[model samples]
Target: MTDEMLMMAVKNGDLEKASELFDRYHKPLYNFFVKITFDRDLGHDLTQNVFLRMIKYRASFRQDKQFRPWIYQMARNIYADHFRRNKMLFSDYAEVEDLKNKIAAVDEVMVEDERQKLLYISLFKLQPEQREILILTRFQQMKYEEVAQVLDCSVANVKVKVHRAIKQLREKFLELEKI
Candidate 1:
């Protein structure tokens, strides 16, 4: 069944259908959380919390809306709430050993792994807003319109944010390469 169909079912009190939505979205949502938080355990918790909130707020979902953007909007709000609660700052860089393990395991792609490590390092160095825009648009492969919905901003604003974030990411990546 389509996600919207399933979600609507959930909204209508067919709570069993929520499992289907969870099965479909858990991994993507987990990866989204992990990428932004850099904490897999927190990702798992946050992902679970999303479904819980979905069920709790099911009545708020509108049939006119698309599920993807709706869910992402919830995710962004959850992440922001967590950020505010923690009152923490992003690290300048993740530890090299930790990043190495997170990036790859294949010996044959050692070179590629190095590149990915640098990319993630650069990503972590960005301001949180810049990092989030890049993660939503580039890593999560969300379109500008979808991101605009998730961020509650104009599509044009999303485009501008993405452009500036990419430019900053490229600069950080190049600077990392020199070290």
Candidate 2:
């Protein structure tokens, strides 16, 4: 069944349909959280929380709306709220260290690649908003319209944000390469 159909069934109290939606989306959502937070454990927790909220707020699901963007919007809101409540700054020194360690663990050869390492460091150095925009548009391959829905902004604004983010990422990558 389509995600929207599953979600609609879920909204109407067919709780089992929610599991199918979760099964379909959990991996992508987990990856999304990991890319943004750079913490695997936290990503797992946040991903679970997203599904929980999906059920709790099932009635709010609009049948006409696309499910991916709606779920992504929920995840974003949950992540933002958790960040704010914990007073945790994204890309802080400790988190950056964690990200570096995780990257190193994933592949020693990746760490050996100077450009790859620099790109990762530069990506983490970006402001959360910029990093998020890039992750959604570039990494997740979300179209501008879907991203606009997730971000609650116009398509034109998403285009501007993505252009600016790419420019900033290029600048940061160059700066890091110099060091």
Candidate 3:
């Protein structure tokens, strides 16, 4: 079933639908959180929190709304709240111990290379907002419209931000490559 259909079933009191959604989304959600936090354990926790909130707030879900953006909105909020509470510096460019390790796992067949590692490092160097725009648009493959909904922003704004983010990432990647 489509995510929207599954979510609507969840909203209509078919609790198993929530589990189905969980099965489909949990890994992607964990990866999203891991990319942001650079901590797998925390990613797992935040991912769980996302689904719990979904169930707790199921009544607020409109059957007509797209489920992907709705779930992403919740994920974004959870990440923001955790960042705010922890006073974490999202722009830190230091080799994320966790990220460095995961790079090899990012693609089993594509042997980890310096350029790919540099790209991931450069991505982490970006401002949190820039990094997020890139992750959502590039890695997550979310459309500008869907990203706008998740971010509560306009599509034009998201497009502009995404463009700027790619530019920044390119610059960062080039600068890092020189080192």
**If scored against the real structure, what TM-score would every candidate get?**
0.85, 0.86, 0.85
User: How well is each residue in 128-171 modelled by candidate 3, as lDDT tens digits?
Assistant: 78878888889889999999999898999999999999999899
What value of lDDT does candidate 2 attain over all alpha carbons? 0.85
Best by lDDT: 2
Report lDDT (Cα) of residue 42, candidate 2. 83
lDDT of 2 at 59: 96
Write candidate 1's Cα lDDT for 3-71 as tens digits: 999999999999999999999988889988877766678888999999999999999999999999999
Clashing pairs in 3: none
Q: What's the CA RMSD of model 2 in angstroms?
A: 2.8
lDDT of 3 at 124: 64
Q: How would you encode candidate 2's per-residue C-alpha lDDT over 68-130 as one tens digit per residue?
A: 999999999989888878887443435566766766643453346766667666776677789
lDDT of residue 72 for candidate 2: 97
> Relative to the true structure, how large is the alpha-carbon lDDT of every model?
0.81, 0.85, 0.82
Model 2 residue 34 CA deviation (Å) reads 1.0
